[model samples]
Target: MIKTKCFFCKKSYTIDYSDSQYQKIKANPKAYYVCKKCNESMQREAQSTTGLDMDVIDKYDKFLR
Candidate 1:
């Protein structure tokens, strides 16, 4: 297991040695890791502030292309 701390919450946690995230972090020592809880919280906060639904943004992106 790879031991690391969450960048946002500063909580210590472990990542499985075989996980893709672990491999990425291993490749870059300066990479930051966000715990699942902080990641979900940030996603929710961002979505709430955006005011537009994800589907609408996706459709707009397709239309632009």
Candidate 2:
């Protein structure tokens, strides 16, 4: 499993998705992973880099985040 930092607190954790998490995501094409603390920070970063407002940031961050 790969290690990634939590978007919320930036704490690192390895992905340990169960079969159910996989199936849930697979069944729902719109589902995605979120780094708890990093999400909002990352979203702002994307917006600054791309010249988008918060609304656009949220909309596009779904794809980029």
Candidate with the greatest lDDT versus the true structure: 1
The models' CA-based lDDT, in order, is 0.75, 0.56
Off by over 4 Å in 2: 1-33, 57-65
Writing each residue's lDDT as its tens digit, candidate 1 over 1-65 gives 77888899999888987544687778885789887788768866877998766556676644432
Model 2 residue 50 CA deviation (Å) reads: 0.5
**Model 1 alpha-carbon miss at residue 49, Å:** 0.3
lDDT of 2 by residue, 1-65 (tens): 44444435757555545422344445654455455456667867987898978765366645633
For candidate 2, what is the TM-score?
0.36
Residue 22 lDDT in candidate 1: 87
